[model samples]
Target: MARDLEFGDFTPAEKRRITALTARMVLPRANLTRLRRQVEDIEQQAERRKKK
Candidate 1:
């Protein structure tokens, strides 16, 4: 049998565990900067291609 489990139904530890598992990971500063630069480069390339 499948039962729905609400967030409130979890104990404090269970809630914390669930929250930690589901949280988004923080990217490192260097990686974030590299990703931003790559995105900007892609956008510039798209603009150049659109002008052609």
Candidate 2:
């Protein structure tokens, strides 16, 4: 089953795990800059949502 994510609810370690997993999925199709930007964007958006 799938669980909804609350980025603010995660610890730093959990956040890093999420980021690493996402990078793994993205690596095959993306260059380093693209991968970095995608991860940064994900983190930034999640942070914005969490503040709401």
Candidate 3:
């Protein structure tokens, strides 16, 4: 089963700082469409329980 995400674990200021840093560090260089495709592939493989 997929683990639940815990956004509540971070304080507001920490969350804001993380958000800003992630935007600056990750968003500019991220390939979102390719990431989406990789996620879909993983989901499909998990559904089928295909071993790597």
**Best-fitting candidate, measured by lDDT?**
2
Residue 7 in candidate 1, Cα distance off native in Å = 37
lDDT of 1 by residue, 1-52 (tens): 0133344544566445444433422533335555445544544544454456
lDDT of candidate model 2 versus the reference: 0.61
Estimate, for each residue in 1-52, the C-alpha lDDT of model 3 and write its tens digit.
1133245544466456546554654577887666555544444445444333
TM-score for each predicted model, relative to the true structure: 0.42, 0.45, 0.41
Query: 4-48 in candidate 2: lDDT tens per residue?
Result: 456665568657866785667656665776656666666665665
Q: Which TM-score value belongs to model 3?
A: 0.41
Q: Total clashing residue pairs per candidate?
A: 0, 0, 0
Score residue 33 of candidate 2 by CA lDDT. 66
Q: After TM-score superposition, what is the CA distance of residue 35 in candidate 3 from its true location, in Å?
A: 0.5
Q: Model 2, residue 46: what's the lDDT?
A: 63
The whole-model C-alpha lDDT of candidate 1 against the native structure comes to 0.45
Candidate 1 Cα outliers beyond 4 Å, as residue runs: 1-30
By lDDT rank, best first, the candidates go 2, 3, 1
Root-mean-square deviation of each candidate, in angstroms? 17.8, 8.8, 9.9
Residue-level lDDT for 15 in candidate 1: 49
Q: Which candidate is the best by TM-score?
A: 2
